[model samples]
Target: MTESTIITDNFLLSNKKAVLLYHEYAKHLPVIDFHNHLSPLQIAEDKKFDNLTDIWLKGDHYKWRAMRALGVDERFITGQASDEEKFKAWAEVVPATLRNPLFHWTHMELKNPFGINSYLNKDSADRIYLQANERLAQDEFSARSLLKNFKVEMLSTTDDPCDDLTHHQQLIKEGYEIKVKPSFRPDKVFMIGEPVTFKAYLKVLGQKAGVEITTIASLLEALKNRVDFFALQQCSISDHGLSTLPTHFTLSLAQEQEFKTFLKSDQAVFSDPDAFAGFILTELCKMYHERNWVQQFHVGAIRNNNPRMLHKLGPDTGFDSIGDYKHAENLTAFLSHLNLTDQLAQTVVYNLNPADNEVIATMLGNFADGRIKGKMQFGSGWWFLDQKDGIEKQLNALSNMGVVSTFIGMLTDSRSFLSYSRHEYFRRIMCNLFGSEMEAGLLPDDEKWVGEMIQNICYYNAKNYFGLNRG
Candidate 1:
């Protein structure tokens, strides 16, 4: 029998225009991954995986979730099972993930790196495993080479405020080919939902900045210092993962007593403190604007739902899901608070919930004041919504409500090195959309015009938007 088609040359491109757009324009553009969870340390260290499972199975919550759903034992996923066992377990789940994005991503990763074209299943598990592991033993499959294989031009890694960014500094000193920059992700500091942990985080930030975090003012100041430090390290982007935007707008709690009262309030629960989050984000955005930096908000993920598994495996082990939280009012208020002062930085807003796609797309246009082309971006499909359908919806929503042409595009937002295939996956879907428009007479059949637009969305837009060409 013929093998399943997952990573074909014309995969997902239905029409002539799409196939041409993808092959001519989108295919060869280098990726600019502006936001991701990739470890700078691994890149700096030039870490080499011992086997395919070491790179593919480990820390990949996407695969872990699928394996668990297939009733594969936990030992084979995020447990004490050997690497070979985990690979076999994932192979078992791959066949069951037919309609899921993982099936395609799995195949794309296999084909791109290992050149393994066979379907991953119970029948082919052992052979594919040995073949991939044997290939991993080679020099080109190292972490850095894997990035180079994807032609990743530059990538911004999500980093905590308390992080020293020593690894980023090391990469700069090593003079690696791809630019790996750190993006300030101070979500935990404002995550006053866990006051005790938040307070501990505050102490760490204070120590990092050589300041005392007694109130919100000091906290913001300490954060500003860290932002300055990150800037010194050539960092130019800030990222936040939030459930919803905050409603309150107390600029800086002027009175000490009021600040103390608010700080000590029982309002800090499992839910994010909207008032505090909005206020802090408003202030942080100003700092970003001051530095001519970009800010990204990954909103509406309800994380760590399974208490039992959360206690055992910890967060980001695939226990998160899309949240239906109302984010418009607070997100609008937060951006407005910054825009009125003319301190709103170039922003990218990403929502996990597909329901909020248009909400965010429309909301972004409210803040773009013609200064920059795509000053405020309705970001690409994110988190649970990065698949084909999700990509189509986000592209359509942005195209309908805002300027999709100038939109900064795909990022892995993942921990694994092999995940850069996601950019290719997104580009194929994007070209198909634009190509179909041309074929249907919706867009003129000017391949040159539409082709450049495809390149802009795939690479150039992000390159210009992030000032990647500036230095």
Candidate 2:
């Protein structure tokens, strides 16, 4: 249970001010992870892992990608290899991930939940695995217990429009203390090009909403129905994943008639997918505004890059990469269109490409309109950019171009329960960034002012922005 030399109390806190800021302001704050991909079923059932690998490695594309880079066999990475073998393989690759965020995250997770601060490697893998597995057998290591242990006050899970939400309902019935709300994610609703998949999704969505979606009008009605359903379930957020915002948002009468025909004829194809998406998404945003909801866009991911592996493993299994889509023009148009209509909801835009950091940061200013605090947010470092360097770049970009003080901070955006350590990792890096500035006289020597900002970024801003503290 003793701390390892590597993961001491002062792990990432380098300067004296950094150490002071971390321990005093950031360390004990309750985490409000506004977005993630955790399983509602697991939390509702209070699922416990049989071993460390079951909890740590399953559905973790980040580790899977790294294992592939190190030439580990697919059998060990994601194939039919036993859990023990997978753990051994991951342990062997740990030392090689020295500079990668995986190294820090791996240790931080182990240190906190398992209280095993030892550095993981091939030699220590077996012993550490046994220790972690033993702990997993205890009640405190169950899925719900883990969230409580991580000091997670609230977290939102990405869910589709047609999701039954039985698990979410179960949590509510049981009165789980942690707020686990579902964020409406209807990305599939925009897939007009893939007629077969889109058609099937529409049927399900229509059935759930109690409306038959035959035309564009009915489609909007069905979506609104689902939005109302989500609101009743205590959902106040919506998320969309796109390469970039669509510019061709207006649908002419001819195009609208064409959409109805496309719905009926299987062979019919929509010529302009962007136009279709834009039209639908614009209407959806209006509905969100009506509900007083927060909308989040996670843009710029080029997914399923490796078609061979994608076919073998299906989507979201370590084949996605940061996309270089141009954002400024279309993003501006999309937001402005909403703003002109007075339908712009509180939006947080997360870009996968590091090059788009300043683009998103500055875009936030164009739409802030003085109505809501941080109405347009440049979201936290996302996907590939959630690491230390990316976090620093995002913070610097916001500090330079936007109001960093009003910024709602980090989100796990992760599937694994153990990924809560990422918030800790982000807090330490943020404290160090500000702490170092204080020591160098770049910022004022007043701890109270800076510490309050740190606390806001760590917890308060997100709490207020999302209205998590409200009934």
Candidate 3:
């Protein structure tokens, strides 16, 4: 009815049943963001922003990509421009991003935290900026405060194998109310594509794990040590970023020895890189299962396309795109490899390419070992596929292929503090999908049962599945 209520009570719920289901059951649930790339240091430090630009535009490649598409200058997009200039640049691009998810996400972030109700454009930008900045300057608008406003009961920020998790420890020392835990992300460790970096990464891992990795077996031991260390910090999950699953292969000891020597050399080891990645990943997963940690695989992202920008700006500055890699056979083989030894942990599979939605949806069932409820989950739409269409497609595929009732749903997978509003957006969509089905008589007209399903998908499922305060 008004700017204050633009994304109000009935934002995405198209029918009476959906609205009733949402406000009654789903809207009040706390968020369980089990997978994300949020900075643990920011949460630990509880940093406050000086202006809208620092929190909104800086380090947000989603905005960077949109601004680039609108022909904004590199100086404003990612260069030495002032915060005011960068905000102005983003303001200019917001109007042009009419149908993009950026448009909705921009508004939700604004409305939820800053209470700003104006559409962002050249005309409204300065007013919105000053008002939002005024709110951010308050004591209640700090990073942790923002998360508190969104009711984030628990979150897991991504971390490297070599990290000491000092910030996670700090959160515990301060007794922060919301649970901020680490998810073990060892992409760099499994990444042997950059042979030079692989050797360098191994040295760092050795120092952290207190073991010199001179052989394949020794490397596995080093990683297992880190997993043990991470477990001590209450880490309950592991995430991998892969272009596709490695082709199932294991090297002989003589070949493994040769590969270990090759890691010490300056030359790239193209000699069965798949086997190398597969070996390291399989071994790590065994440790993961032993620790009873959930494993997540984010597959089908083709990252760092522009070497020119990559050199100047570095990775995750929006040079990435969806990869077209075939995932079915290799993915099956990879999961099967872990399962054959009874070592497959609770896994959530995320696909960036929508074409693989059904392929992944069905593949999840093959590894259901009856060890845990929803032991194998088709993860929420990730990265490039986190929009409304992509989100719906993932829900549809999972509902058709698996038991959607037990499905753990909706993670930001984002680096922004303001991104928690995404859970609200996702809950709205989930309600609308279920609501539409009920309105059409596809699902039973039981409000209590269906409403609880909405709650479980929004919060309880992830909270219970991840074993956070589950009593």
Best by TM-score: 2
- Clashing residue pairs, candidate 3? none
Residue lDDT tens for model 1, 1-471: 247655789999999999999999999989999989889989988888888888888888888888888898899999898998888888877888988999999999999988988789888899888998888888888889999999999999999988989999998887878999999999887766677787677778899999987777787889899999999888999998888877775644344444555456654452336666667778888899999999888889999999999999999998999888998887888888887888889989898999888888999899888879999998889988999999999999999999888888898999899899899999999999899989999999999999999899999999999998888
lDDT of 2 by residue, 1-471 (tens): 223637789888889999988999999999998899999999999999899989999999999999999999999988999999999999999999989989899999999899997889898899999999999999999999999999999999999999989999988888989999999999999988889999999999999999999999999999999999989888999999998999978899998898888888876579889999999999999999999999999999999999999889999999999888999999999999999989999999998999999988998799998878988999999999999999999999999999999999999999999999999999999999999999999999988899999999999999999997685
lDDT of 3 by residue, 322-364 (tens): 9999998998999988888888889989999999999999988
Task: Mark the 10 consecutive residues where model 3 has the least summed lDDT.
Answer: 1-10
Better of 1 and 2 by lDDT: 2
Ranking of candidates on lDDT, top first: 2, 3, 1
**Candidate 3, residue 416: CA error in Å?**
0.7
Q: What lDDT is obtained when candidate 3 is compared to the true structure? A: 0.88
Score every model by TM-score: 0.96, 0.98, 0.97
Candidate lDDT scores, in order, read 0.87, 0.93, 0.88
Better candidate number, 1 or 3, judged by lDDT: 3
